[model samples]
Target: MGSLQTNELTLSYGKEPIISDLNLSVPEGKITVFIGSNGSGKSTILRSLARLLKPERGSVLLDGHEILKLSTKEVAKKLAILPQSPESPEGLTVYQLVKQGRYPHQSWLKQWSKEDEEAVKHALRATSMTDFHDRPVDALSGGQRQRAWIAMTLAQGTDTILLDEPTTYLDLSHQIDVLDLLFSLNRVEKRTIVMVLHDLNLACRYADHMVAVHDRNIYSQGAPEDIVTKKMVEDVFGLSCDIHMDPIFGTPLCVPHGKGRQLLKEKKFTEKQRKATLVPE
Candidate 1:
């Protein structure tokens, strides 16, 4: 596993800064999650790290080396990114898609090798997609498709993996299953996993490191327990909430308070019950 660092990383789209003066280090071989409301540049930061979007200023460093300066193939050998939306060629089989991840290591003279074949097989097995290896990518369920994409990234065998909203279209059970798979990759394979997550509770439960991005910049970053607070929630998300420890995960759990019909209905019901119990005047 490799430690990824961004030193004063600043990113902008056409002179409008999306993320500015961002300085954060992702710990080696751990799950780090970026949480923020939509348009907070969480995806932008992930893209920057993947070198898919060039930083307007500052640098992304992988093990003290400038990532931007490295060749595309070189960077691919060290890091793999599973973007929020990755398109596969039409009619591509799962095995074929997974094999494409080995491109960085392939050359004109050397195409597919025994090692590459083994890596592809291992990746499919790791993600539990071995049975669907022969199936067309378009035919798989959303969760199955997501797992196939993950298997492709795993086939790269890189030390660091960056993902953007890996559980986007998955249901509750699939979400937990995917997260569990990623957690296992971090624990068993010692792979550094960095992801952008929308679910605060899931982020707290799964992430070893957390970064909150807001207002086109980083709001705060640290361990979930240290960084997630009532004030942090209110400031970053503009939502009033109480931060409590999650009984199941031992992480910060956010309980949001807002103007809702349920609250009004409950209060109204209590008031009616009170009147019904009152003695005649």
Candidate 2:
């Protein structure tokens, strides 16, 4: 797989810089997640990596070459990006939306081919959206709609894929479904996957590598267990939280301190009792 990295990169809005002199590399063939509070430039850095936003200084490199120097089709052929809460054109069917991903590979000399068809087909199957291909994108459930969008990216036939806030607006079950799909993709296909996630626990659970963005640059990066801590959460999110090991995934879990009924006072609560207190009958 090709590599993606930033060398002293600087990003800006108009004239004010948001990410400055940031140098980081996305590990190929693994799942990497960027986490931080709002406006921490997670999306900005992601966009620049996809060439959706031009860097103000330095460079973003894809496969050891400056991304800006590559043609749009060239870059798209090697990488695909799905923006936050992607929208489809009105009346667009799931199949039609996924077919658009093959545009980068098409030309006047060569039109649709078996490779493109297989790509779309494989993407739909991989995302579990094959049954919804005939349905309109807007008609699917939130999770299904997100899956369709991811299918489009998969159809791009790229070694690396990037997404921004892919789980935004998804319900708890749907969020797990989506993340599980991505985790499977990385594990089975060995594709380089990078994304921005606001939920720290979920990010830690799925990410093989985690980057915490803060104050215009990366605050820390490494395996979730290595870099995720109480201080990192407090400093980056400006909230008090306790870091614990997730029993199921063995990843870092952030339990933020907040106002709630203290059931742990003076006695241990069994799982049944805890569920009884949290769940309304």
Candidate 3:
């Protein structure tokens, strides 16, 4: 189990703080998902926890030690992050790309080991990308490429894995595939999984822990059933909704009700029904 906590974490890129005064604890060996509207600081918090972004105030601690003070290699050994937008070097084969994850584990004198080979193999198989290991990454489909990237992070073999919007560009089926893979890793492999997600339903479905961020701070967090409510959605998302139990997952499922475009015939029928009168023949 790997424990990560933030103490009043505040981060800013320039003059303005992207995230402010945030305190969060991620339970070890579980899937924790962060959810919010765009620009709600979900990515910012993930980046800070991964030590990709420096917090202007507060601190992020990994297992009770200040993470920012640790050396880059030391931090890499304990945690791995796949950012919202990870770059792929041109012409890099899948095997070569995943091999880079081993950088932190290697010493100049002891570059490769039997253990490293096994790790790479396990990671590729876990992501179901073993078939494409020799293919250039750019040649794969969008979903396949995502799986490859995830494989690389898995190959890093850290106790804590942080992923920022890992499902971006994936279709519904592929989205579930990735989330399911991570869920298994958490439950079976006992790895810590943390990710940012745009889909509230997906978050509620897969997350053992959930954090809702709004206006640069965490608005609510905890088990989905405990934290998600109609009022909470209205308050954070500025939308009215009924919170219902998801039929498949038995978690709180958010259903929004508000104004939107509808067919003119449908609108006319609604008006006619409201007046309890039939339309003129």
Candidate 4:
């Protein structure tokens, strides 16, 4: 099993540390999501997990070995990371982008083998980008471009995948599409998914384990139902919200107490129906 954990980890951009002395363990073969407010160091933690950012102190261990000690290609063989809003060359084709994932396996002696070709094919098929294989990544829609990026990571053939805000910059429909695709990857292929998300409802829906980051440390870490409460929302996010069960998925749905349109005047209503309704047409 592929395992990742940080021992007393600290991170920073310059001298001021953004994340300090935090300990975290990612669940194996499950979907783990990190949720926090903006500038709360959620993305910083993910970068550190993938060893993109060097830790100011302590260490990140991948399967009981210090990650820093391993070579880049060795680490790539075990883990793959997709940064937020990644970019490609002006005319890079989707098929060409996916071929880069096999770089770790290539050497002077071995050029392109049948195994490498099969891996690229599998990734394109898995992401449903087979028809668009020759299309340039810059020409695709937001959702389609994101899928191409995800396909590159899949071609890497790692048990663990890390993504930063995978659903950002997409419309609501496309957001669900990416989330559903990742859910299928975890459910069917049993890959470990670690990501940062802003939407609480979607995070609670997909996350088997959730980490709430605040104040340079993790506020809570556990099942979403146990950790996502009214007080937790107030403390962590500085917002007052009522937590209710989602009708379809049975997860936590947060209704924020903000200044929005007030169509429902009555505070007293049936427990079953939170919104106002009319009986007759």
Provide the TM-score for each candidate, comma-separated: 0.92, 0.92, 0.91, 0.92
Model number with the top lDDT: 2
Residue pairs clashing, model 3: none
Compared with the true structure, what per-residue lDDT tens digits does model 2 show for residues 1-281?
98999999999997889999999999999999999999999999999999989999999999999999999999999999999988889899999999999999999999999999999999999999998999999999999999999999999999999999999999999999999999988899988999999899999999999999999999999999999999999899998888888999999989887533344553366668868778332
RMSD of 4: 5.2
Alpha-carbon RMSD, candidate 3:
4.3
Which regions of candidate 3 fall more than 4 Å away from where they truly are? 261-281
Better of 1 and 2 by lDDT: 2
Q: Residue 115 lDDT in model 1?
A: 98
TM-score of 2: 0.92
Ranked by lDDT, top first? 2, 4, 1, 3
RMSD of each: 4.8, 4.6, 4.3, 5.2
Tens digits of per-residue lDDT, candidate 3, 1-281, equal: 55799999998988998888998999988889998888888888999899988899999999899998999988998999998757798899999989888889999888899999999999999888899999999998878888888899899999999999999988899898888888888888899999999898899999999998998898999999999998788777788788999998799889876433223345745666645653433
lDDT by residue for model 1 (1-281), tens: 56688988889888789888888888888899999988899999999998888888899997789898889998999999998867898899999999988999999998889999999999999999999999999998888999899999999989999999999988999899999999998999999999999999999999999999998788999899999999999888888989889999789999998555445545644656556755222
For model 1, the local distance difference test gives 0.90
Show how many residue pairs clash in every candidate, following the order shown. 0, 0, 0, 0
Looking at candidate 1, the ten consecutive residues that score lowest on lDDT are 272-281
